[model samples]
Target: MVNLEGKGGMKREGQRSLLEKAIEIILFVGALSSIIIVFLIIAYMSLEAYPALNLDFLLGWFWDPKKEMFGIFQIIVSTLYVGVGAILITTAIGVPTAIFLAEFCPRNVRNVIKPSIELLVGIPTIVLGFFGLMVVIPFIRDNFGGWGTSVLAGWMILAIMSLPHVISISEDALRAVPNSYKEAALALGATRWQTVKKVLLPYAKTGILASVLLALGRVMGETMAVTMVIGNPRVAWIPTSILDRAKVLTSTILLDWSYVEIPSMHYHSLFGIGLVLFFIVALIDVTATYMVKRGVIK
Candidate 1:
């Protein structure tokens, strides 16, 4: 009986050690796999874009494919134009909605609103594109004559698509502010509006800024919805007005994909655009990290 009890205890210890080892191995594998995947993607992009890397390729305005030429200037300008515009719109609408939800909305109202925003996030990209094409495109065409399929249309659609992410993240950030801060402000004779603008906003600025950067990243990579509404014009400058048609990086890739031959420079150019996009996202992420580390964000 003494021998059996000792053996049973040994088996239990062995099982526990095995389980711990297995978990450690699994976690290490997962982390290593993620790093490997990211590195492989960067490596592939670099290899493909290397051939076309030059001052001319980056600065040239012309993108004539028939002559086997490509330039990213126009695409870059359009990307910034659309991205900035979408960010502005999303901030204006999303931030206010977040403030309302976090500070003023009743619990019952919040339950409904939160679920609706969640639903919006759950909707697929293709469905959003279709909705934009069917509803937004026509509305712009009818009300804003001569602005058919223009940057304004794309900006509006993208702003709508970006709303859920901005609102959800910003709301979370705002709510993370300590209740004591608000109570202290109120006790100090500050009005609710003043307290929100002066205290809460300052405390939550980092989170709000991060949310905006994240939204910008989403707008930059967005293809389907923007492609449908942007009209895909072959312009080389930022659109002077909302009514002007513009060509963003994503639209250019999709528009030229079918026409480019295999192993061609145009094919390489697509990869180059992808590289540019990757770098843009990386820059945003890095900036956000820096801000967080610097104690700029609460």
Candidate 2:
């Protein structure tokens, strides 16, 4: 009977090993497939956009469909402007909120605040856009004495939209810091503020930067919300002020995509803009990964 039991246990172990191997193979294949799809998308975009790549095409400011001329310089400028502004605002609001939640807030308050922030992440972008249009736009117009649909409105909306992501990521980074570090600092007679500023902040700097980069990418790629608030304008250059109407790449694409004729240069130009946006997001991801890895090494 003991021999029979030992034989059954060996068989069970063998089956478990086989199942593990199968699961590994499946995961490996899925990862490979994902990588292949990404490469294919990049190749396709490059092929479509290559024809539209010329000095005149890039440098010209006109986007006339009749003339088949389209330059995205203004759109690119607006995207950068709004994206940077949004990132700055989100960082300002989110970093402090994250620090407070992670280090200062009571456990009950932290629980409530953390769940609320996570819930914000699940809110639909279109809904956020509509909210901005109805509430934020009117508030801005009434208080600031400008058109409701302006770059500033777009920036503020995008900042709010990105806040959850920035705060969550930053909070995670802060929470990941070993309690021992704080304890050691306290033992050394450092005040809470000093310990947070000198020890915690420096230790979490890379993660914080990574979160900011991720927020930047989100602000850059966000379409529906930004489109609703950006006050799309057919301008030859980026607007000089926050109150001025502007056109971002995503907004331009959303506005023009349906009307653009198939196989036309205008359509191709949109694809080219998409390619550029993709690269910008990709660059942010790569930079964030590098910063995280460098921090790990340090």
Candidate 3:
């Protein structure tokens, strides 16, 4: 009977080992598939975009397919303007909300509020764009002035879109700091706010920056909402201020792609624009990773 029981235990261990190995193989394959897909996309875009992928297309100020002009410098600048502004607003509001939720909120309130904030992510960008057009645009026009569909409107909408990501990730980061650090700070005669300011925040800075990076990516890549509110300038227009109407690269691609024939210069140039966006996002990710590694961000 002892021999029988030992044999059964050995069989169970063998089964568990096989199951674990299978799971590991599945996860590794999944990760590898993602890497493969990204590379494939890059290769495809590069192939299609090579004809129009020169410095003249990137740095020229005009972008009229009719005139055979496909410069994206101004569009790129406007894209940066809206993206940076949105991130600034998102970080300002989201980091504070995260701090409150992580360190100061009552448990009951936090439970109710945290999920509600995250729920905002499910709200469709089209709906947000419509809301901006109807409400935010009118408000901006009536009070702040401008065409209403301006960079400021784009900034405001994207910030709202990005807020959920920042708050959720940043709150998690702050909460992830060891509780022992909080305890130590308190024991050292630090007030709750001081402990949060000097200990919790500093310790979780890396996580907060990660959240910001994610939010920046979201802001830069967003399409419908920004397209609707950013005035979608069809010419070579650069924003002089937050109130100026301007074009962004995504909107230009989105608005123009439907009209262009496949294999046309316009179509190839659109792919070139996409490639530039890809490179921009990649550069941002690489820079942030390097900064974190070098202790520049932390």
Whole-model Cα lDDT of every candidate shown, in order: 0.85, 0.86, 0.88
**Which residues of candidate 1, in runs, are more than 4 Å off?**
1-23, 234-237, 293-298
- Tens digits of lDDT, candidate 1, 215-238: 898888899988988888654457
**Mind giving the per-residue lDDT tens digits that candidate 3 earns over 142-235?**
9999889999999899999989989998898899888999999999999999999999998888878977986787778889999899898668
| TM-scores for candidates 1 onward, in order | 0.90, 0.88, 0.86
Full ranking by TM-score: 1, 2, 3
TM-score of structure candidate 3: 0.86
Comparing 1 with 3 on lDDT, the higher-scoring candidate is 3
Clash pairs detected, candidate 1? none
Consecutive 10-residue window with the lowest summed lDDT within model 2: 1-10
Clashes of each: 0, 0, 0
Residue 143 displacement (Å), model 2: 2.1
> What TM-score quantifies how close candidate 1 is to the native fold?
0.90
Clashing pairs in 2: none
Top lDDT: which candidate number?
Answer: 3
lDDT tens readout by residue for model 2, 152-206? 8988889889999999989989887899999999999999888889988888989
